[model samples]
Target: MRESRAKSVWLQREPSPAAAARVFCVPHAGCGTGVFRNWPPEHGPVDFLPVELPGRLSRFGETMPATFEELAADMIAGLERYMDVPFAFFGHCWSALLAYEATARLQRAGGPAAARLFVSSQLAPQDGPVGRMLGMDEAELAGELEAMIRDQGGTPHPELVAVYLRVLRADVEMSRRYVVPDPLRLTCPITAIGWSEDSEVRPGQMSGWPACGDTSFEVFAGRHNRFVDAPRELLTTLCAGMAGRGPSRLPVTSR
Candidate 1:
């Protein structure tokens, strides 16, 4: 486990030196490594690394990324020294896009790109915005925010929620304010994961994952933030997928 202020990041690793693949788990905006603290220890096979971005959690003083591209660059640089093993990238929401971008940067930096890219609760870039709250006025945005919480039910701890919400609002501003720098693409395989009830990412839009790489889609019977609502299922799905194996479908029992 290491940290870098240059990139405004913190990270934790549940390492298995003998593991076949290194799994990098990127948290959603306004989230941190604590979100994944319990994950790697319980999952079978593969090492786990949870990233903590600045402007959240303990690193609140560090500058948060203002654009996906910049965040990607920072993550790539931060992880450059650890490219010796086969690795996979898993991210949720804003981090999903970051996973794609970071995979591209790793490739450009002359390393083996992620063996697999797993993205949750987000649409492909060309798919355009879904549930865009940044553009909403304060009152309307609050309603949208509440709807998000109601739909996902992964609202952070109340204290953390207040702080994270403030941070998330800033991140939304950043997302809304970003501009694409180049026509970016990746050759790695991508798997789009989202809830059946998630309006943030449409099924047709998930098919667009092919545009990013060799792609597939898996839907769960939940909402936007499946991790918090369903950790075991999420980890099982991710672990199975990372092993180049098929998913073990869970019954439609909402948590």
Candidate 2:
């Protein structure tokens, strides 16, 4: 029963037997594993695993975590079983904060540390919790959420939008309360990725990541949502980063 419950957070039940490494992808605010449905199963020797946080999708019945720390702890519990092999955590937007917290906590606890932490389109913890979403009113947020749904080629259903609004608001509040004035540096390396046209979190905002550890920065050409498509350049970076070959502090334009 315990094992089954732990597996609930992962969209993939079994780790790839032949994989040399794993990349656990955490969705952005108010989203679920389905965001990664278009991503390839394998990128070279690495397996892509999408995580499903509670209070959304299949885990909709579960209560949302009240704080980032609580959410990190829950993530650790769910991911513990899959950490035996070399693995990395990849998170975009708000989930990047959760990934950082989890990686920091794992190192402090003397647990199996992550090989790398890939934070995309988010400012470092010390620079946050700061984002445009935090300042938006409910009506504005609803409009943004609807826009997102429409962009994804889905018509916004009133009932679904209402449900997602609550989730988004909760996530925004959680992000607002997570101010890490002084962050714990991780033992593992970090790769801070920025989108060239990301209006939400500018590439310059991610410069503080070097203070987190042996950090590298990469800026890919596209908007904030481009990573959702798992573009070839992004996949190449993930695989190379795992093998310790990612470019250092230079932005690479992807065509």
Candidate 3:
């Protein structure tokens, strides 16, 4: 495998070959590593590596995965090169399940194992998906898109929104048809983060995540998209968890 290929695919604000540990983050649907652009400043103990999925953002030239299997395969292939160091996984929304499955795939492939798993604003793999975006028409989706952009602190320009809509529609359709997995339990600890104000996903919905492993739940103050901008609180907890030492308590800002 070409080492440079993984470098281009994963976004690390501070490229640290000397870090003690690494945290590879998986973004939500239609999200890119751009969210972590301002995080983890240089010299952090753990390397903050945010993965950019194919078919979106900088990877627009690649075809998007049509199903969960394809997504997992793509992740396994692309990330196998980075597993030499002690690492953890963090993912949000629908992609959180993707991260879990990818971790399993890594172990199955005789690749590296994650030190920890952090899934936020999403249910466990057994619960399946819970959104109606798949059934919405383009017009309805456009309306939702505009509102979503506004909530994320951005004004959607027509052309840009159109492109975003395309990626979102594909992502939603993929999620809607997804089959929940009978996941493999990990030896590592799992952390489920609930967004206090995120009506889309409640803390109870993610309670099942503990079944995957030795899991803990923490709540942060924010809506569903709060982590998109890479909040300081979120980064701190992730860095600590991936550091692979000391107490593993997460700072909870909410229930």
Candidate 4:
């Protein structure tokens, strides 16, 4: 019953039983697994499992997690069964911090530790609560949300935007309240990925990650949201990173 509940609430779909390894993808603030709908189900031996956090999409109306610690605990509980295999966590933007917190806690819990934690376009915890959205007021956040919808070629409905605005505000507040002066160094290595065109988080800002664990940094050529498309280059890097191979430093060509 616990496994059934975890599968229904946390994951978008059942994981690939035959895959050699899995990479659980956590979305950014105010979003759900739909951000990863376009991503391939599997990239060679690695299966991509997009996480579905509460207060969004199918989990809408559920209470949003009040803090990162709560959020991490919930994720760890929901993903316990799936952790039997070699696995990693991939989080983008705000969820990168979530992934880090969960990985740290999971390691200390005497469970299967994550093989790697892949944080994209986010600063290390000690260097944060830093991000443009952290300083934005509700009006500015609403505008930002609208702009994102427009960029995706969708018209933003006022009602939907209003709901997402509340979720966004809560997420932003959670981020603001998260102050990890001295974060726990994880047993797993970290792969910090920076996008060349990401105006929000420059690669230089991610320099503090090495303080957390054995870390490798890679810069891909694309804007902040490009990872949502699950580019081949990014998948290659993740595969190599999980396999304990050194950074490929793949030659950047136009996306």
The CA lDDT at 241 in model 4 is: 73
Off by over 4 Å in 4: 1-7, 248-255
After superposition, the stretches of candidate 3 with alpha carbons farther than 4 Å from their true spots are: 1-7, 10-14, 41-43, 245-255
- Per-residue CA lDDT of model 3 for 95-160, tens digit only, reads 888888777677677677788888998888877777666578988888887886676667878987
lDDT-superior candidate, 1 or 4: 4
Number of the candidate with higher lDDT, 2 or 4 = 2
Q: Per-residue lDDT for 1-255 in model 4, tens only?
A: 434543468887888889888999998987778888778988988889999898999999799889999999998898878877889999999999999999988878887889999999898999989988988999999998898777666789999899999989999999999999898888788888999988988877888887888788889899888897788899998888777884734323323
For model 2, the superposed segments whose C-alpha errors exceed 4 Å read 1-7, 250-255
Every candidate's lDDT? 0.67, 0.87, 0.74, 0.86
lDDT of 2 by residue, 34-124 (tens): 7788899888899999988888898888888889999988889888888878999999999999999999989988998899999999988
* Pairs of residues clashing in candidate 3: none
Question: TM-score for all predictions?
Answer: 0.78, 0.94, 0.86, 0.93
Best by lDDT: 2
Clashing pairs in 1: none
List the candidates ranked by TM-score, beginning with the highest. 2, 4, 3, 1
Roughly what TM-score does model 4 have, to 2 decimal places?
0.93
User: What CA RMSD would candidate 2 show?
Assistant: 2.8
Better of 3 and 4 by TM-score: 4
Clashes of 4: 0
> Clash pairs of candidate 4?
none
